[model samples]
Target: MSNDVAILGVGMHKWGKWGKNFVEYGVKACLDALKDAGIEWTDVDFVSGADTVRNGYPGYVAGATFAQALGWTGARVASSYAACASGATGMNAARAQILAGMADVALVIGADTTPKGFLAPTSGDRPDDPDWLRFRLLGAANPTYFGLYARRRMELYGATEKDFAKVKVKNAAHGFKNSYARYNKKFTEEEVLNSPMVSDPLRLFEICATSDGAAAVVLTSMDFARKHTANPIKIAAISTVTPTYPNTVIEMPNFATDSSAVVGLPDAPFRDSIAKAAYEEAGLGPEDLDLAEVYDLSSALELDWYENIGLCKEGEAERLLNDGETTMGGRVPVNPSGGLACFGEAVPAQAISQVCELTWQLRGAAGERQVKGAKVGLTVNQGLFGHGSSVIVTK
Candidate 1:
């Protein structure tokens, strides 16, 4: 009767602009996950894939595409697309199947081959599409929103550009030894501060870049997992909650916040609610987390996650970063895999990649970036629109 699903294996292709087809990257990661799980492609009864919008037709039907690429093993296939939360969506699908007795074993995969420069909206003059309207009218690219948040934090919480720089500095060092990280170079606060500003208060080093990468995981029912391994990292909860009405905070691809004129605010903010639901489902809390991997789209955003994920209270994230509580060997290391700061954004693959890092950490195999005695980890990321992605994993 447990809601937990066992994570038998996790894998990722090195993050970079390899320029090869996304399918190749996905296939490699899938194969690696299968090998790690000690299972065969034919052994999987379900395939759940996160869709990549940038890729063509095959990307749309990623589940079937990967199934075909892996030789059509008669596995049931499903694909999910929720912008940055795509991987979590696919993961939710796989977990549902396993928990519902539809399948004993499932494979979840995501990959992306990104385009250069700012991630713009898809072509055409569609006014109805808020994403397109944002680009066409206000030119409010992703960084623009990032900048707005940074500036707001600076104003309300006294967070300086230096505090933001320290986030990049810390994450850079964490990722320095990470082989899967795209930017494995250590960075100094000076270097971060000196870097050109992409968004006000956000330097080039602070903002994550677009990259090509893939990540995958093998999941099974607890009964199936017990047959294979004595101990397995269990996915305790997966939260893909949608934003409540009157989502006051402005989200990405949208120009304005929801008007609170008629409806009252929800009891909790959207971002805070994301992890809250997962925590409730897992019977855990922020205090129970040994470590966390949060979406760091911008260096300043990492601090925001500290509060949103309950690492600290609002306006206290800068204090946590400055106090070293969120660093390696600290109370609760955040982004031990270097986060998006080191890996950049691979869209559909990002959330799954976060789970992969947690899987390694829980197994005590994360090498230099490992958090000592790490038993439980959480990942929180938000995709465009109101997609909320957060997963709780425990050893």
Candidate 2:
């Protein structure tokens, strides 16, 4: 498909446990994006915001709250929440508005201060919330699910604990150069293996921590973009896909996977399904990609995406890592901006931040972490359950 929308600007508040209000981060990121675009808040035709549930009332109506903060000009407003997919969902909302002629320019925002330790349900009571039930009843913390994936890899693919630790080591090395990363310290493979285990099979470094951060982007119609500057990176496709019925694999906040007793399992897992949609929409295969930024909640999960995103054949993910094919000098570098290993899991902010990294890399502006001559990049953010977002961009 042809590109219709241009990412004129991208910005973010550094990811860390700053112990501050979510609004502060959002406002900071918005201002930076607006500045980068050379477009004032008053000039924006619309503003889209991602919900940060921990903030109570403000989160429920994030679009207006952010609008008011930036001196409201009656820009069209939209809000969305989908576990970790909030940022990309907001981007999609903004992009759709522009493509539909509802607006010429839009600012997409996703900001949050993640809770300490495990993220619990927003409401105090109510078994209706799957997050609450998973914590209260099953004691299935997020790490437990990460453990399951890791153990499964060990059993099926012969992936060892050292392989998992290698992911932490690689990401930490990448994080050391990223100023926005929450943890900039380089991790040694030995340190990762020696660190205390969180959930069995997954060590401390193997899991991402929670952090406070915000990221925003200015997306505009291609016509408006040409008037502003030359050589703009365009958003080629945005894929938000859910699993087909009978999703057999276990996911976060869910007690159990869907039963295949009645219906046989689908050919592809939800993660691969998400990437497949993106590739189809962009009219490009995994071989065409210059790089990818994936949700690496765990080391094993990072490897899973190597196969899930079709960078390699199923079960051949180990070869990619072993051959240094996923590194900066590799055929398709993954997570050159450090990713969650350094950025942490800021539910709302992370998805947009991944795109920000993509924008910089595509523009040849990502200084130390630059993917040489990068022309195409994709960001894959999978939320709890079936909510998944994948964005494909090109220069």
All candidates' lDDT scores?
0.94, 0.89
Q: 348, model 2: CA deviation in Å?
A: 0.6
Where does candidate 2 clash, by residue pair? none
Off by over 4 Å in 2: none
Candidate 1 structure quality by residue, lDDT tens digits, 37-83: 99998999999999999999999989988999999878899999999
How high a TM-score does candidate 1 get? 0.99
lDDT of 2 by residue, 237-294 (tens): 9998888878888898788889999889888878889989989988998989999999
Candidate 2 structure, TM-score to reference = 0.98
Query: Where does candidate 1 stray beyond 4 Å?
Result: none
